[model samples]
Target chain A: MEVLDNKITKFREGLAKTNLSFREESLKYAEDTLTELDFPTTRVERWKYTRVAKIANTQFSSRKDVVKQLNLPIQDAYTVVLVNGYFDKELSSKNLPEGVEISATSQSANNLLGKVATIKNEVFTALNTLYATDGVSLRIKAKTIVDKPIQLVHVITGENTIATVRNVLVSERFSEAEVVQVFLSENANASFTNNVSEIIVEEGAKLVLDKLQNESESNFHYSNECVQQASNSNFKINTITLNGGLVRNDLTIDVDGENCETHLNGAYILKGKQHVDNHTVVNHLKPNCHSNEMYKGVMDDQSTGVFNGRILVSKDSQKIEAYQSNGNVLLSDSASINSKPELEIYADNVKCSHGSTTGQLDDEAIYYLRTRGISEKSAKALMVTAFISDVTKRMDNDKVVEYVHNQLHDRFGWDF
Target chain B: MIKITNLHASINGKEILKGLDLEVKAGEVHAIMGPNGAGKSTLASILAGREDYEVTEGSVDFDGVDLLALNTEDRAREGLFLAFQYPVEIPGVSNVNFLRTALNEIREYRGQEQIPAKDFLAMVKEKSKLVELDAGLASRAVNEGFSGGEKKRNEIFQMAMLEPKLAILDETDSGLDIDALRIVSNGVNALKSDNNATIVITHYQRLLDYIVPDFVHVLHDGKIVKTGPKELALELEEKGYDWLK
Candidate 1:
């Protein structure tokens, strides 16, 4: 404990002026919260399957650089470019859409920032809060239904750098918007990316978030997404983790209002020695709310994956319908996965169920494809795409679906 | 186009095909009739390169290429098609898309270009009529929620699309109705030509009535104990296997 405290103190000192700037009050409060927190150990029940020893033992310095090059995959959409934890104006769009705002300046209303994400056992979010600077504050005005998606991309250009980014997305009443957030690295060197996102969907609003994590094999990525959904609102999140050396993602959604709907879907393909852990929580606090969560993983070679999903319905949350399912396919004997889907309901009138399944690629199915003249590689790719299609097809956006499909195919060197 | 010489195969040390030899030529239709546990399916499985069955002796030649040396998919690309007894249900894979992919792969193997979308669709439409496959089934997921008869007919429809040089029907008549059986056999007959052959594997003589075979072989305990003309099927159907032994 003493050694960890000393390391964290030195880490805080190491992050001193490299953040560009943070609101003084927010920084102090975040630091105070950090003092009361610790890196999650095995003792933490929520993080039992994930081992963070290497992360806790390694120290990463901050990086600062101007944006060199960035590509936007989405068309006719506003883009915000953040390079090495700071916003880069040269790479961002000059023309902002009407009724939408993207700014690097901090906002004073911190209602859901620290409320949705649990801080006691989350060191990444706590650290992000303390060192976040130049993060965007995006607001979609009420009754503004944006046809084009808003894209946010972060590119890391540093070696062994710890890049912390914080962003807040708000969709006001009766508004609808699709948002795509991408995390990529230049492969310049090994690095760690810690990202914190807080989303708020007001009454009668709809927000779709697509997060694509396509990092180099040498990088480690940690992301925490906290969502607060209001009455009659619909919120959906699709996470596609295509590649990374080590990755951990935490998504917690609070369905706090009546008649609200939430959808949480994740798909990941891991090969080589890559490791990925996805932990999600959906809390139902009101009546007549619906939430469905599904995650699929395909692991090959000696890679490992972990999925822990928990759905909680409070005592007064009546008539809540919640379902969670996790499916994993192991391609090699050495590949392994730990999946736990749990449902804790205090409401007598709620309908909730959770299931976890793990298996290898179906041999009979492969033979069937082969007998039809499909090669082994093509057949395996087809089966994998089919396995993950359940989650990918849930994506209502065609562009996002195509992007994910391309990534999955390219991972196997299969032609799309 | 296929020749199996003194073939010996086993599964887990138990010999299934013991010293079995057969010769099939282009434009020939051969029916292998057998009783239960007679290695009828094993023969078909081995010919299609199923890894579960290991051949300990002898060899198979497909169009003069050592068939035993090829992989399951390679055998398939080399113009050998096996219509499974039970078609697998592949969810999220449409019938047309899967057929297109398979056809393209086969063409690529044969040094041909991919078929245009319009031509492929037209071919699908024309061949689907051979087995009377519902147009809706071609657009839906492959064999998903299909009836037993529909699955059998779908297999024939696929056979028409691939148009292999050699087609093996492994109990394709089982679980199918009389109408389905007639449609399936007719589809097979329509695809047969001087350049192609068909192997019909069955336990009953009922299917042979629709698609007459030039030669009929009785297999018992992994070896061909009898080889005769189309009349052999009627004899087996009337007298059963007791007299053949």
Candidate 2:
């Protein structure tokens, strides 16, 4: 009991210090759940390859500082800056298009706060709910087509800092929008970022979320995104992870309506002692829905990668088609990957498939390239680029694709 | 352009090429005909620096340099080209992109400026036409889903683009039909000049019919047993390799 108390005290020392307000009943429930749950272990099925003891044992303090400017990837985007989980008004853009609103999640008193994300058995979601400093609540009104993409930049700085944020996104009927979430860090050592997002797509709405995680090597990141889609809605998300010490992402999307399209694509390139875990779940509740998931990873040195994709087709949800694929390439003997694909179908007349593959580069192909006067190093680089491009190409944004290539070249020395 | 003196090689503790000797000068086309298991492809592999074979005792001299001392890519940069008997199908690598990279790397080794993009595309257009290869296939993956005849023609097209001082065609006619064989031979003959040489390794004497070799060497039991003019190919094709053995 004393050890658990000490762990909670250290992890939550200076968190939830913002003066912003939140729902009274929701905060009470989250705090009660935190007392009942502890940090998960590797023995857990969802976290079989990830160990979170380092994040639990570290003593972190809340940090908030001012910065002059940021080198944003898309210069013309409608930007929002969150520094150490605090919304920076001066750094964010004030001009907004018609029918689009952006405000702090803490100040927004909406009934949809605890509807999508569940905290009953999820420890991270509970932690994020209780100690979230501040985040953006973006809403697109009905029938609004936002031409410019919305950019959300989460900047983490200082040593031993812990930032917990909560975001809410809602796309109304017949609306369309794209959101880019970029996670960056500076001078961070042993920092931890715990984030949770609850999203909703109304009828005939379209939303695309492109996330880039490029934190420092010493930082730990955990993100939980829960989405609910209505009828005739489309949702596509791309998660590109370049650098992180230990990262875990939980994406749960529920297709509660008919004729919806969902696409989940992710690519992670890891080296050194980094570890990344991606767990996704798609639930088909209505008839005639389609979903496709593809994830690719390239691990080098002592890095580790994990992928768990689960598809569930509820009863009476017929004529559903879902496909999932996960592929990995291990660049070193010490690097490894653990992949698990699961499907639970209680409905009849549905088509679902899942597969996983892991292997090294082809040696015969290398020799063939060498005979054409290409060095072995460049040969492997070309093949790896081709392998990862399958997922990166689905980003569908030129600026984001260029940013990913630049990150790969700067961090892993892989020039395409 | 190349000289092999008492060349011996083995794979997996079994000898393949034993005491093989051959020499070729610039502007000459040499045809090496032999029965199967007589180290016809083995000679091609060793000259191109395939690491699977262990050179027990041998020396290969190319243009006054020790060919056996260089790596496979270094040997390629030094003006040696080998068309594989079975061209590997590399998915996701375009032929034009790979050839461009190869050309630039070779030029860098020779202390030359990078080829301009305009000139590179022009060269590709001209060289691909030499073998009658479709310009669309140049942008597709290398040898992927290519027909056997198309693959053979693609090999000749690559040879034309590289323009090496010494070219080795290893069973380039094995899977090609008569039309493809004629086209490939025509491309090879068109690229021949006074500054380059070619070694055509074939089991039958069909390829030599078009690319008319100056010297025809009959290899039996891992060594060249007879060297004669181009008429020797017809004689071996009629009498079989057992007479030479």
Candidate 3:
């Protein structure tokens, strides 16, 4: 393998030096893959709608520091804080439950890190694999039902910086837990975050994860979530992105066993020159499995949104039911969306469906509301709220929902 | 309570209401009986500030205020309501929630405080009953999946909640059954008062039989061709609109 691209060489040389080390074997694999991979361009099918030239062509510095006063959405949850891609022990919550273990990936001996999230074909995953500073490592013991939610807060600070954060979560057999991962920024500019999360749900285990990305308008965010589910396991993830200059999320779920349930939902609100792209794939390898995915977006000003959802049912995966839908609302003539929902079924006895809709708000509905003494602004707000409520209501966490509503109000002046 | 003079309106450069004039005093119900394409709905729409129509020459006076100058919501805030012929279905927006918003915004426009949650709920309960509307329907999405009769009843239910001074029922009886029409008329009659008036735009005399309009006007060829007592509805019902034309 040879690294010939000068852009890749420049980006690699600009990364902050890492004093922490991980498994030597995994690191070698990542190094080899990184040498063979170049920065993706528009020609790449997966990164077609997303452009990485802004990240690749710029020089970035990595700096770490502890800050005072970290405002969290869920305050009562067991919180783990990471500042500038490094864990800050002084800020994390202490006194975990008996059956739950929460530690930084740099401190934990995690064998499942590179097993689920492959760095074979993806360049960002390889980059995160080689130079990840710190991330969360959460493990739930078998048959243990965690009483409280666990939150991981990743805060990026400073200007012209890059943070590679990698996380691994393992839910043992018959365990149930809820985890929230929030990406926030503090006085940051021209920053980039490359995040990769590897999740494993054992047989009879259930895991629910909520991810909120609210970075600054000048930051770039890219995240990859790789999940594997055993037989009789259930996994659900909700991705809510409120603000960012540029964001791309890649999520893959591999259902390797029978009788598993998987749900993936996302909602994004964009304004200004923001851009958000979400690509998700769900592969069903066994029978008697169910998967449902829905993503909704609202774009205003000159913003753009892209959604690509794929569901693949392998041969002999009988009795598999999969549904995917993407809906978008453009508030301005300059705003736009590109949505494609694809389903591939190799089995004869399977039910798979996909749909995509991109349009403006219902004009008749707006007029109806206006005739009832509601202002045009409020009418649009109400209709947009109703449009995205399908995914937001299914968030199932009132605190998170309230926080999102508050953010909407603060950012866009939408009363709903 | 309201008066319109020489209202000329058009949509897509095609004239709908040409030199149309109407007047409704306090404590009266006027039924507008018209054939198809006679500008009945255009009159109702222009009064409620539907933007699709271009009002070439018109002046609407609502209690000495320029009704035409206000926007749709402002016109609504000024106590003018239009019960649409086809009520829109707004999915996921509950009837009660939107009604509360409309009522509060109207109140705010009138320099009043927000309604208390308890009192608002009580009002919803009372108003829904007047239209014989099911209590569950008030909490459901606005007109979504409602039967035709139920949608008309919901319109009446909204009128009862808002308590407008000049309510224009534009073909509110079009899709209603006999029983539903009676229920809706009864609700409208119960809400009538000396301070408010109603303009009932209908094609039949059955609704007038229940609500008992004070006067009936035959609208034809973009204008009111004739006006008479409530018995005029009976006459028009007996002899078709051809006699007036």
Candidate 4:
């Protein structure tokens, strides 16, 4: 307790040096939480494969007046940008679709702090809750569908900056919508990002969430996304992480009501010395729920990839069907991958299975293509594209799929 | 157009073809039938330039040039085609795309302009009918989930598309039913001309019944034991390989 108290005192002294707008009580809460809690280490079961202390030990500086100017090349959506964990009202507007409401919640908002108190055991969540200056709160009305997507851009700049952003989304009954959250950082500067996103879907609501992470080479990022679904709701999530320094993403979904359907799909492309870790958990709390998960990774150079997925079907969740798969391709000998796909089913009448495969490009397929007069380089490129096309084509969004394909081409130096 | 002088080949340091000699002229169909361990398929593999098989002592001449000097793709682009005994199943590669690539590669090797897409589609439609292959099947991954007869017909379809000078049908009749055999044989017959040659490697005389060979050679113990006219296939079928052995 004394060691933790000393650490908390040091952290508060460091926090006092930054000119952040926070209430004294919130600052006291942050210090109290830091003193009471211990940072997650390798000894923890969930954090066994990924070590976060490497970043926790580093000192990060917070900059005041570090404004960001974001110009999204992609159009046809409402854009919201956050600079250094602070929501920029000047750059972000409420030009949303009908029946949708978006607003910023400050630390003083009623019930906001208590709503996140349940997740205090999550160190990052507690930290973000205590220090989050401002966050976005979005709500969609019942029986209304939003045609265009809602885009949220989290931009981080300056060196040694530690930032946290929080988001909460609630979908009314039978509402259908899509949201895209993008995390971007400029250049190779040491930084840390801690983010928490919570989503809840009412009965019969359909929601699609796409998370894109494109961070700088010298940053450490940890994100937690929690989604809960009601009866007959449909939920789909597509995560794309490209070129990150040290990134860890935790996606936890609970089908709390009957007859719900969920799809979790992701693709990660890592190069250089980057390391990307994805941990996903899907719990079937009710009967007759279905879930599907597919994650693919392409690791090049000396990069590393880790995928840990778990599906749990409760005792009463009979007739629940869940499938999970993880596939990886290592382009260089120095590249590494650690994948674990697990299923725990307490229900007897459930069809649940999981599979994982890690290997190099198919040599026989490459040789077969080459024997047909195709060049060796072209053959390898075609095989690689075909291997990844299975996951990309499932997106069903032509533009997004094309963007991923182009990113793959840029990574492999292939024209198509 | 093709000559093999004392061609000796081995796989895994075990000799398969020892001092085998054969000549395939233009506008000819030759059938090489042999017992199981007679190195018949090995001869086709060596000719098509499979890397695992080493040519310890051999010289092959194709179109008045050294054939063994070229790599696998170069040999393929130089108008050589080998219909495998068991066609490899390439998942996620469309049959139409594979055929188009092979065709354009051969065209580029010959210094000819590429065939336009419209013409290529027209040619595919025309050749697909020759092998009785459904138009829908051509759009699927190559040889993936294909029936035995469909796989054989697809081989002929590819042969018609590539139109190589020397088409070696390695056991094209092994897995085919009567209907598939007729379609494959008819496709082969239609593709054969005075400018191109075919080498039909089979274990039975059934395939030769439809696409009759001009010459037949019985291979035994990695050497050509007997050379005769097409009627020799029927004779071997009647007496079986025991008499030849």
DockQ by candidate, in order: 0.77, 0.76, 0.83, 0.49
Candidate 2 ranges beyond 4 A from true positions: A1-6, A17-25
If you assessed candidate 3 against the hidden native complex, which CAPRI class would it receive? high
Q: Residue-wise lDDT of candidate 4 within A128-150, one digit each (tens)?
A: 76656556677889998988777
- Provide the TM-score for each candidate, comma-separated: 0.95, 0.96, 0.98, 0.88
- Span of 10 residues, lowest total lDDT, candidate 3 chain A: A14-23
In model 1, pairs of residues that clash are none
Query: Candidate 3: which stretches are off by over 4 Å?
Result: A1-5, A16-25
The digit string of per-residue lDDT tens for model 2 on A1-416 reads 12345466567666654443546676777777667657777666677789888989988878787767776768889999998898989989999999899998877776677678873567788788877888889999999999999999998998888888889999999999999999988778889888888999999999999989999989999999999999999999999998989999999999999999999999999999999999999999999999999999999999999999999999999999999999999999999999999999999999999999999998898998898888988788878988888898788788988889998988866765
Candidate 2 residue pairs that clash: none
lDDT of each: 0.86, 0.90, 0.90, 0.80
Measured with C-alpha atoms, the lDDT of residue A265 in candidate 1 is: 94
State the displacement of the C-alpha of residue A300, model 1, in Å, after optimal TM-score superposition.
1.0
The regions of model 1 sitting more than 4 angstroms off are A1-6, A17-29, A106-118
Position A18, candidate 3: lDDT: 42
Between prediction 2 and prediction 4, which has the larger lDDT? 2
Rate residue B161 of model 4 by lDDT: 84
* Per-residue accuracy of model 2 over B34-120 as CA lDDT, tens digit each: 999889999999999999999999899999989999999999999999998999888777898889989998999899999999999
